[model samples]
Target: MGIKEQIYNRSPLFLQHLFTTLYGYQLHRERYGPVYQERFRMLLEREHTTIDVKAEQLDRLNDFLHFCTEHSPYYRQLFASHGIRLPLTDLSELKHIPVLSKEILRTHMENIQTDIAAPIIGKTGGTTGTSLQVRYTIPDMQIRMAHLDYFKATHGVYRGMRRISFTAQDLVPERQQVDVYWRMNRAANQLLFTVKRLSPRTMAAYLEAIERFQPETIDGLPSAMIELARFAKREGIRLTCQPIAIFPTAERIDAEERQVIEEVFHGPVFDQYASSEGAPIVSECRFGQKHLHHEMGIIELDTDGEILVTSFDTHGTPLIRYRVGDRMTLSQRICSCGHPGPIIESIDGRGRAFIQKPDGQKIFEAQLASLVKHLPNSIERIQYVQMTTDSVSIYYVPDAERFSQSDERLLMERLYRLFGRDIHLDVQAVSYIDAEESGKILLVKSSLTG
Candidate 1:
């Protein structure tokens, strides 16, 4: 840890809160400056426009491409090698350029980044075990934050509101003896909850803190929210605090999880699709429709449901035709929300989260989740770990009263049918399944190397 962390670990809870507030103030200054204000104003004005969005997209795409060719060495050579010139009249011509993969970005990061001064650095959550560091210009970061804040504002959440965030941020020290697993960010008017110490034992404390805080907005990993919701329901602990909105981030939430969170929090759950890699925003509207922010970037869907994004905001690290390794189904039907952007039917998270069959076929996370969906609350949580092609280990937390031997048999039978008799299924009931280092639960963890 750093010097600050060393001090924070030794200090008392009140001092830690002071440190967090000080840090939050610093971040607030960085994130919500004049540039942020300007971008936010522009976004608010553009939210309900009838102007030609397609024409504006093309114009922005040309400008961004021109900037990349002029500043970024990697894109300049790649575009030149593909015989692509600046100012492409149509978006279809972008197909000439190759799709940038995660591995390619990691290998060519130095060349890919432009020589900008004082760029903000960010790291990916590394769910696939390959974390990457990305850079963003100040203006780019401001615009991204503005877009996120604007999304929250539309959902009845605004700045200075008391918000509770359950994320992987290391706010609580491991050696702390107190029952407090949270820190107060006075500057941001936010309560930061650590997902590390969350369990049946410490859940009451978390709930008590949240009730006392009375947060207007709850945002963070959906898995953490599900844990709290499941615990609250099982313990019959009804909270009097009703948030204005619950925004799930950093993880994909299915319909069942969404319903549980909404019921527990007594608020609407609005899902969003964005990445730490500075990808454009795809936020859910009030009508439960996911709309792509056309001004932010362009999304091109592949036949296999993979998406290639060209983010206009990633000027510091230009991501043109970047394969972000997430799948989504595009909708053809118009939304009743009156947002003039394309609709995303569903976000199938992390193409890497899959099980490899003996015949080299892949069963994705969403498909694997369906196997346990009919368990009727008997299974609290489940995880699939594939170590080799022939074997898979299933770890699940089952409610003792509800989960019977027949439930285990039914789950095993379903797995056997899905894997065929060739693969080995090792299912075990456990107290809990550990989350990833980032504190986000991965439904499927594959150890096989490609």
Candidate 2:
């Protein structure tokens, strides 16, 4: 290991950012605490209240420009390629800026990362089944810590309250050390629950941990959260500690799933948008306003609906205009929360879809899941593939005992009700559905595309 990485691994989270000029920890007790309470109160205000969100966005953009040019070799070349100099006065032509793809960013690691006292490694989870190792400087690690603090504070789960985080790393083999370190760093107010072994029995153990720990909040991927909630509900376990919030990140939180989480937690559920390639982009307020964390970076929705992010926090690898594969709507409407950051109405998806057409009319990817949910005791895990325009293949992962002819027939009936008999139904019992490297089960993929 390099001296930089060795130093970073041993360094405390608080000191990590202190060494970085580009990074600053969000002062939760000093500044963010009062602002957080005030923002929650403002959320009670009517949506019509005008908020000056653009100014904050501009401020973030300025910071991003400075951070990129000063520290990131990738951004320096990118700007030079466009024949642009520093002190960019206008973002009007931001669409013309280069979009940083994951592939491109990976190839330029040496220039992308900063030299720190310690080395930080870059990693991708199994959600996409793509495990990537990237390196970080001590400063880069601090930026992440600061971002996490900002996100948690925004949701009122800042200090004094314990957080029980359900992480996908709990299930993976290589991430054990990271899980251990994260747990130790936040030991005073955090409990780490691994989802790697989320069988019925293990899930029961997780439930018991939550009951015993009685954390002030629950944070993890939406998929993991949903699974835990389902297991808890089935077991008749009441997680009624009245946690300040239930925070979901690392995956899309659909309306139905959000409702389920809200029902399980009996409190407000906040959705946090973050990625391996970018800083925390947006977070939802109690009023359901997804306030873009404009303080950290500049983000835009591209013409193709992909989220483009640029962060001032970039020291290791600078991302000027990075295209995050996810989809979202950039709202012009003011959030009832008085935060000056613009709101995102919804995150549509990661562009994964299963095209289904019954009578020449296209069926959305979501409709496949809808069909399965109506089936009698159908397993919630399902995937659909469109072999041809007319033929559709379905893969359903069901519990061992429940995978029977009767269950198949009931599920087919539901599909027939929606798409008629011309569509194909292929159901099977697999030991498990594969999750993306990020540990999110896609549930569906489409060969047929527009």
Candidate 3:
């Protein structure tokens, strides 16, 4: 642990709250300054306009392309090699540029970025055990924050409103035996709850804390919220706190989980799709439709539904044609909510969650699922655990009547064909597959550090 964390752990509960509030104040200043205010107002005003969305987007895209060509050495060299001229008249000209993969970003991050004074650094959650660090300019950060705040404001959630957050952040000390699993951020009026060590035995404390605080909004990881909601439902306890809305981040929420959350909390769930790497946002409207904010970025989908984003806000580390490793299906049906942006049918979580082979190839989640797709109602759920490059353990929940020995043999044959002779596949039938330490259920869990 760092020295500051050690000091925080050693301090009394009251002091911890004070420290959290002080830190929150610093963040508030950084995120909610005059730039943020101006950007937020612009966003709110833009929502009401029937302006030519595509034309404006193309203009912004051209400007951003010009900036990247001027500032970033990687993009300048790459574009020059492709004979791509800047200030393209049409958006279709983007096809001339090469797609920037995650591997490219990992290898050439420094070259991808423009040198800026004291840029804000953010890191990905490293769900695949390969974390990515991204830098943002102050105005970029402010604009991103403005977009988020404006989205929430549309749902009747605002800054300084009483809110409860359950996230992967470790707020409570591991060794501390106190029942308090939360810290206060008075500057943002947020009660931050730790997602660690949550169980039925300790859930009452969380509920009690929520009841006492009576927050207007709830935000954080969907898995954590689902756990709390499931526990409450199982215990036949209804929360007294009626939040304006529940905002889920980091992880995707299925229909069942969303229903449970809304049922327990007595609020609507506004889902958002964005990345820690500062990808452009696709926020759920109050009408339950997901809209891509055209002002923020351009999203293009490959044949496999993988999205390549060119975010205008990523000036510090301009992400032009960045393959973000997530999949989504775009919708042709216009949303009745009257938002003048493209609608997304569904956000199909992360497409890049994969198990690495011994020879450094990867078998992603979609490809792995194809092995059992031919089976008829046999498998309920499946998970792959990779501790080493050469071997993988598959835990599967099977239907008793349908999952025959022949089906297992067929699965084994398919696995061998996909993995080749060098790999060892250990497929086991299990009643249940466990979630990760953060309570999120991952299809692929690899301990082979990237």
Candidate 4:
């Protein structure tokens, strides 16, 4: 290793900003440009922000249709075959455009190309052990960040703050023994930490880095935060530093996990709902209201509860009426936060976590998390591996020294209560649960083709 690897002196921070300045121009600069800022500021400033939702949706929907018909051969052929006309005046008329699926995109990827110059290929984090590749342009990147900037404001996270985040970056080498686990991004004041090496052994090194940096906000997935809290609590390590707020994304965080993280850091965990397809979907406010970013996309729910999104401003890879494979419930009540927008009642993580019962009934993984919620706060990470149709294994990480036998029995009982007599449940308490290769933590995985 290097001698000055973990040291974040002025020279290192300056060199880091150079890369961040060029690379993050679209994320930081384009999103905060005068034009983008004006529109974003107006959205926040408008007191009586009552606009015709159906009309705006129809207009944006038609605009997307017209663009697709002109540039994308796949969309053009589909629209022509289905007799879809431009200038849609009614929102219900969007039904004519068939829902675009990921399989269809893969099959006709070239046909969907808009002839943009040297487009970038975007990959989904593949939380379910499978990765998806999609083509995007510069404009698509801008719209994604603009949407992020809009919602981040709701949680009091402005640009250029000292935001410490744990993402899929490979800043730290896997085997290196370093004093710090984080690297400084001087341009944005972001302390980037690698989530690859947060085992029980090196968890103390991570705490040392955080204690030194003293970041303003903590932005990362819930799995990372929960595991950190588990190690701290288990070791009886008291953190004298706390962030202003915590922002979690890209995973399903149950109420219990959020409470533990909040207690450990002494901050509120503001969770967000988004997809890897460059669509910013939902966010929470101070009043715990989940607001749908209507200005970002026109969101709709399928009969099966799949979230269909149309990116109104994404010109690079326009996801018009795209089935994002996630479910959401719409709320009729307005937000008490005084933000005039549509609200989402709830957002179920991904469609992969629906575990089946013995009676052929399916239950969300969040429902199973409730069983352990009544248990002690020692449970940190939870994962279920369905070995077969009649056999299942659950692996969990504990904050205490070890999992007690009674705790194991209670966990088994919960599984039996969930899957019933037809299935065999095996509970194991381990040091840690592995994240996906793409660095996403999946709550459940099924190997059986049932």
Q: Estimate each model's TM-score.
A: 0.79, 0.62, 0.79, 0.72
Model 4's number of clashes is 0
Q: Residue-pair clashes per candidate, as listed?
A: 0, 25, 0, 0
Report the lDDT of model 4 for residue 316. Answer: 56
Using lDDT, rank the candidates from best to worst. Answer: 1, 3, 4, 2
lDDT, candidate 2, 279-319, per-residue tens: 55677776878877655677777776677787765555666
What is candidate 3's lDDT per residue for 258-319, written digit by digit as tens? 99999998899999988767789889998899998788998999766678998999988788
Which of the predicted structures, 1 or 3, would earn the higher lDDT when compared with the native? 1
Local accuracy by lDDT, each model: 0.80, 0.58, 0.78, 0.66
lDDT of 3 at 345: 86
Task: Report the C-alpha lDDT of model 4 over 1-450, residue by residue, as the tens digit.
Answer: 124433413234455445544455545654455656565666667535677766766776777778878888888889889988778778877877888875455445568767655265665623332224566665555555656766777677787777888864445543345455666666578877766445566678887778787877888656667778877888887787667789887777778888988887778888788776666567888888788766667787887777788776555566777876567888787778866666787886543264555544443443444445434333555777876566678777765643466766766765565566776777777877787795656767876433
Q: Compute the lDDT for candidate 2.
A: 0.58
Report the number of the highest-lDDT candidate: 1
Q: Weakest 10 consecutive residues, lDDT, candidate 3?
A: 123-132
State candidate 2's TM-score. 0.62
**Per-residue lDDT of model 1, residues 64-113, tens digit only:** 99999989999999988988987988888877789998667866788998
